[model samples]
Target: MPRIPFVIPLLLSLLGLAACSPPPTLDQQLYIWQRQWRPAHVEALAQTRLDFSTLRVLALQAHPKAGWARAYPDLQLLKRDGRPLVAVVRLDGQLPQLDPRAIGEQITSLLHDWQAAGIQLAGLEIDHDCATARLPAYAALLQDLRRQLPAELKLSITALPAWLASDQLEPLLASVDSSVLQVHAVSDPRRGLFDAEQAQHWAAEYAARSPSPFLLALPAYGVALLDSPAGAPRVEGEAPLRQGGTRRELQADPQHVASLLAELRDDPPPGLSGIIWFRLPLAGDRRAWPIDTLLAVVRGQPLRPALDLHAQQNGQLSELQLVNRGNLASALPAHIELPAQGCTAADGLGAYRVTSTPQGLRFTRQHPGQLAAGSQRALGWARCTQIDQGGLHVEL
Candidate 1:
């Protein structure tokens, strides 16, 4: 007798499981774009982290919570519970010219009223792009707003990383107390994170000259869709699982994130303040990925030195080790040594065509090869560069 086919039922079973699977817990500092925040999703995420007294959920509320608290009027423009939230106004362009002083007064008064209602605020977060050039006049607005604002409330402004530059820097900087350097990876369809990284580098340059402290806003959200060709920047959300621009199912690869943190642990930049993540959400991870990887970094928690970068004894192009010794996850650029080759300092590092193996040992990275997670191999021809002395430069 012929056996019954199993594919149809199996597919239905998976669909049911997908529907029934419980949403993950939300533990990060919570914010709401309202446009994207679903009521149930909000409740699901909020309820999960609420019991953990160690964590505080701050809502960056763009749209007020619907019936947030029974005691408070819904959309009353007041605080619910006790956390401070950023009130984000949605502007889809459309304005021909904004009167700087008038607009400033209007927002300031509304914010004051919100403050009076016992609502705390980090600051007003504005989201706009190249059009934000109106910021010089807007700076005048912020100046007045800043003068009137409660001293404790900080100011914030958001700008797309792609277009931010030295010329536009001063005007935007003058407008706010802080900067959210949005690595808007999606705006560039050709290459996502490459553009994003370029944005960050340029932002860092402009930010260095500006007066405001800018938080690099890496995309916590995934790429809306993958529209580019091969060899684009690492996928938007997290590494590994989301590589090549896959969305929603993104994850912060523990190994990748861990490597980056290790470098920072090894070599920290002077005058750098602190690293802020784009969000605190359910993480939507069923496997319960290590959030502590980032938490440990944030707390200045000590981590072990797992991934070691060393010059190969072979003298050919050596593989660089991007390893994860800590229990938590981190991220790092698969660094080739400084362009100058044949340089080995007291510290074990070299420049050019370097790589590491899966066992966390140094090897050679090739022109056509890659070092992912726990593995290493050699790549390309190793020609000796002129300069040869000094330890490898690392950021811990």
Candidate 2:
């Protein structure tokens, strides 16, 4: 018998053409991320003792370029602990990065829908291959979005560490959520370049005057700088971007992540928020979102972070974490306990969502049939939109 290979889809990007359609509602965008994870279980963070309210905004990275958003659905998925916050809109090659006005309009629409849904939409995450000279255009686009958004929504962007004078871009970030310094691609610091540490220090200094929360994006996707085409990252070069590397050559791991997380965690920076990973199901990476390892590091937050969450008008991400660790074979009709909030019940993870009403939360299954053992599921798709959160008792 011949060996079989996994089929990977090569997608055509929507970027450079960001806003071909009218803006989508916040509820709609929420559906997009929902499809990413399935057959897995999510549990309340009653153990970490970490508080979502204490942290800043939560966000998720999406590659609109990878064709992820076409189906983003609506759901109040994020377990929002508190308000005066916004989730990130990591713009992963989704739009054509060329048209400034189009970008502005797209972002404005996002802000508007979040507001309509009663969400405190802080702002967006602009990810791009930075061209130092284009800072002016970037700032201009941000300003445009700011002007269009209802003054309340802020903008957050990801930048390579090397752009020496990040200080120069301070004014732009000041208008939005703190800018996250992307030090992952910056593999070398020797040739007038900057890496994560240097970027962190620089961002810290820049934040002094503006004083907004800051975030550092670590690599969930490993890379080796193309120092000699042996899989090297080009933090600030015209060479094509190098995405995956052998796990050994790669920089992403629990230990490496902890190191980065520790640095950001230790910082006494006033508005410093936590770190955000690149994307879910990161292409070519061993893992997508390391919910278990991350939960092990920081647990127990009442509300899910904006970065870790995605929601629609009715659905929000409470938290997609690991309660049983690697127990994939766990049976369906698994018991879920939102104990800290006094909401305990058994609901199939196969359900799309759990809705909260005056009477309490409601858990409805997405599919008609019962979920099998070790299955993965998420709340939010139109078909699977089920409520599994309200306190209750059930039999699989």
Best by lDDT: 1
**Number of clashing pairs, model 2?**
63
List, in order, the clash count of every candidate structure: 35, 63
Model 1 / residue 84 / CA error / Å:
4.4
Best by TM-score: 2
lDDT per residue for candidate 1 within 125-240, as digits (tens), equals 65544354565655565576677667877777665544443365677577677765555443544433324335435554645565755554433233333434554433333223
Q: State TM-scores per candidate.
A: 0.45, 0.47
Q: What does the lDDT come to for candidate 1? A: 0.43
How far out, in Å, is residue 151 in model 1? 5.0
